[model samples]
Target: MSDKGLFISFEGIDGSGKSTQARLLADHLRDAGRDVILTREPGGSPGAEEIRALVLQGDPDRWSAETEILLFTAARRDHLERTIRPALAAGKVVICDRFADSTRMYQGLSRGDLRGVVDRLHDLMIGVEPDLTILIDMDPTEGLSRALSRKGAEERFEDFGEDLQKAMRAGFLALADEFADRFRVVDGARAVDDVASDVRAVADGFLPKRRV
Candidate 1:
């Protein structure tokens, strides 16, 4: 792949500060004069946004594991076709807040089948993988507490309870271990600025030489 552009993704449990760091990195890159596009999965494009509403705020009891996975992929397909691919083709650095990994974690928690879902999605859609994935690792209990304290509402899968979140965390960690080269697990317990700095360092490693 060319250094002209890069696709970097931030992944983590809710309240792990992935969005915060993603925005910070985008700002840093923009200040340094890099063309960057900061976006999120499940809602990047118009079609995806509608799907996101359904998936996130709609009736959870009406959703099955298979149906949920399909909805996610449908949104992802729209996002890629409408936003991600175009930005990358324009040679802009693309920073996605959440991507396929989130689906693997969430759906894996709901379904207990990680390998099949991830592999099938990779095969069917999601042609380009992130150049680097920053997995903001945090303890599920702490992360959940922070999330609930901050947001004050549990939507859809987040309402699945604490044990599910813990299992999802374990799934993410296991993926990090298996794909060491592609994954960077950052300790998310640090101060916000500290975590952002760590994320910036990881991003800079993939970026071309430039003073930030």
Candidate 2:
């Protein structure tokens, strides 16, 4: 692992398995003796988790796009203060399931064009992007099927349905060009282990040599 901290984030539309891959990468690096912190947003720290429920658990229309953007940024600020920055300061590899990219897509793509707001808020309050972002790309129809098969209170985002998901997937792909230096697009339609193997390979290339 790098002695200097590494920050990584996993991003994709719902059920693209980014979260699972984030967890697997965390575990894989830990097994090789790297210190890792695995977390997610719209929740990571305690205060952020509270905000997450407010933004993600209610009716799909509970919060307007503008209001939801504020909530997500608020949560991200708390997460950075209480969870991410501290871990990175301690030289831990911080792997987050979703970060500002979700905001860029969810609010900026599906609901409204809030990319400027998202970017400015991030620049103002949460001024750090992940060192690497793994975008798990897959067909939205398949993603929705997989997402709907699961049960969770966090289904508010999924309730937006397949059309939005497809649009969001395209939005994420487009980001590859915008953030080419930090973005890696991986096909997520494969088996879990296969995708994980690919993810591990990517992460290994990004980080320092294994120290175990």
Candidate 3:
């Protein structure tokens, strides 16, 4: 590890249980006597949280793919400045629920072929990737079912329907292959504790040995 603490991100199609896994990992790390901060993307900082409302709780057609990319990038910049960077610099493990990889899929590929745009914006503004990215892979159909059952206002993306979810799952898997060094794929179709165990093991391999 660098003088800075480790950074880990959990990603998956909607309702794949990545969020639950992220929290569990944070708890586990803290129990093991490591400093940890659990945060989420598009809403980590005050400013970003406002933007998150704009982007996540509107019509599916609320913004063009390009506009959404810009919004996500702006929110991410704020999140990094206000939350992720400081935590990592202070030697606290940063566990993020979602990060730029979501942008690389949702806005980058879902609507059009704008991945290059996403990558360029990310490099220019938020030029950081998680030290470890745990992708909780799941079947898109089931994932969508789980997502819609939540009946939350943040279902704008889920409103895009099963097609988008399928695309997202494939896109996430592809990202895992593309950034294989930092990405770890874990099955998320089992019981919560079982999935959490897999996530914990994957994270444990990346985390440095705890200081005694």
Model 1 segments beyond 4 Å from truth? 2-4, 152-154, 210-212
> In order, what is each prediction's RMSD in angstroms?
2.1, 1.7, 0.9
Stretches of candidate 3 exceeding 4 Å from the true structure: 1-3
List ranges where model 2 is wrong by over 4 Å.
1-3, 210-212
* lDDT string, candidate 1, 1-212, tens digits: 32357889999887777888899999999997899999997789999998988888745576877778889899999999899888888889999999888887788554667558766876778666788899998888888877777753336666676887788788899888977878998999999999988888888888877655
lDDT of each: 0.83, 0.91, 0.93
Cand. 3 TM to true fold: 0.98
Q: Write the per-residue lDDT of candidate 3 for residues 90-123, one digit (tens) a residue.
A: 9999999999999999999999999999999999
Model 2 scores a TM of 0.96
For each candidate, what TM-score against the reference? 0.92, 0.96, 0.98
Residue 112 of model 2, lDDT score: 76
Give the per-residue lDDT digits (tens) of candidate 2, residues 1-212. 32369999999999999989999999999998899999999899999999988988879899999888899999999999999988988989999999999999999778877889888888999889899999999899999989989988889989988989999999999998899999999999999999999999999999877555
Best-first order by lDDT: 3, 2, 1
Q: In candidate 3, which residue pairs clash?
A: none
Better candidate by TM-score, 1 or 2? 2
TM-score ranking, best first: 3, 2, 1
